[model samples]
Target chain A: MMSFVVGIAGVAVFSVLARVMQSAARGTSPVAILAIAAILSHLASVALGIIYVPQFQYWSAASIFSFGVMSYVFVFGAVYKSVSLEVLLAVAGHPDRAVPLPYIVGHQVPEIFRGRIQILIESGLVEQIGSTFAATAAGERLAARIARLRRMFAIGDSGLYDFPD
Target chain B: MVGLVTPAMNFLPGPAQTAAICLGIALPLLLLCYARIPGIRGAGSRFRIGCATAAALFAIACAVLPGERRIDDVAGGILLLATAMLLVYVFWGLLAWGFTLTLLTTLAQAGRPLTEEQWAAAYTQGGDIGKFARNRLKLLLGSGMVAVTGDTIAATSSGMAIARLARLVRLATGLR
Candidate 1:
């Protein structure tokens, strides 16, 4: 019970610290900020538990606390980067709760594509040559690693949802 | 306050947690072994099978481990397994279905500079970006989140609710 309490306290600390760090430094990656906050808070929680709780069970506390932090990161990634959610949000936010197919295919999809490209550029993975783009050497190595994993897993590179016919 | 200082708190969860840790380590190994099998076809199918096998083994371990299982032990065991599952899923998603990663891979494979249109074309294996957009829309349509009517797409009620929820998540996660 004390372990669970400490774990939950760690989650709260992580959340508050993450929000504060992100607000203060917009240039840092949010994932990095959240990860740092999670690690620090978890360590603090474990230290406090060791000092206060008799017979402190490290694994029990770590399990629950890691679960909470991972779940938060999962939801955060989904909300931040899911293109399907973006499409849904776009339609839902429209005045009529609808949009023409052409608007979606032409404008919204292209905007999303460009946005991803910008992310790649910002991350130093892909470089924009005049009127064209190419992956950097580092990007190539990373891509190769991802490709090997996908091949090992028999996953396709399309990144499309497989709808059963 | 007494709860905080309770001596001899025996929530050590030793046996079950050890079992959970064993199963967690076995999960990726199971996935790799499953990949070698010709019967399992899709990545999703293989992953499901791996998780199921791990879960079944964990259940067996819980039953077989020589101790009276406490509630805290069982709960902690379950939490550890769940955390392992989520961590693997995140890594799997990144490797298999990450859009930005795919884009980088496609460009790397192309070995030449590509205009935006060319890159989209390559990404879809010669189909245009519209094909990719339609593929994503298929998920929304299949999930009943959105409906298509004659040339237009509209959000269903569930879609609106999910959108609001996504917004709330973004706000709470400091993404907005």
Candidate 2:
């Protein structure tokens, strides 16, 4: 119980630290900020546990801490820029909570598509040249590795949910 | 007084925690084995099977391991295994289905510069961006987050609630 309490306290510290860091540095990636904070808090929690809590099982503390942190990250990632959530939010924000399917199909989805392309470009993975896009050398290497893994695992590259055929 | 306050220190892991550590290590090895098996087709199914196998083995280990079962030990073991599963799933999901990663892979496979139209086509295997939109819409509709009425879509009541929750999460996570 002491370990679990300490683990949760670590998570709380991570949350507070992440928010502060994000507020202080606007341009930094949230995921990276969260990672740094999580590591720091986790180490602190373990150290404090060892110093204060008698019978503090290392694995017990680690397990609870990992679960808490991962769950936090999972929720963060899901709500970050999920397209389905974006669509839902868009419609829900509308005056009538509705939108034309064509508007979504034509305007919103393409905007999202372009937004992702911009992200890739910013990440230096893809390059833009005269209204066309191509992968950079680094991007090619990564893509090749991903392709190999997909082939090995028989995973489709479509990136679409594989509904029953 | 100090001695009365300080409890006994035992840093050793419980039996179930030991079992969890061993089974957690075995999960990725099991996934590698599953990759070689043609019977398991999709990444999702294969991963699910791997997790199920690890869980079954953990149960077996708990039952067979020579230690009196304690609730805390069993619970800790479960949490550990769950953490491992979540970690591996996130990594595997990124490699298998990450949108940005797929976009990169698609462009790299193209071997040349592609216009927006060509890129979208390649991304969807000859389909337009509409296909991608429909795919996402399918998820929203399937999950009852939205309802389609001929040409328009509306968020359901539950959808609005979820949207509100998502907004709260975004605010809390400092994504705004």
Which digits, one per residue and each the tens of the lDDT, describe model 1 over residues A1-165? 778787888888888888788778788988889889998999898888876877877777888898999998889889989989999999999999999999999999999999999999999999999999999988999999998988877778887666667
Question: How does chain A of every candidate compare to the true chain A by TM-score?
Answer: 0.94, 0.95
Best by TM-score: 1
Candidate 1, residues B65-142, lDDT tens digits: the string is 897997777788889998898889989887777899999999999999999999999999999999999999998998
Candidate 2's C-alpha runs over 4 A off are B1-12
Lowest summed lDDT window (length 10), candidate 1 chain A = A156-165
lDDT at position B7, candidate 1: 47
lDDT for residue A101 in candidate 1, whole number 0-100: 92
- Off-target runs (Cα >4 Å) in candidate 1 are B1-13
Error of 1 at A57 (Å): 1.4
Ten residues in sequence with the least summed lDDT for candidate 2 chain B: B1-10
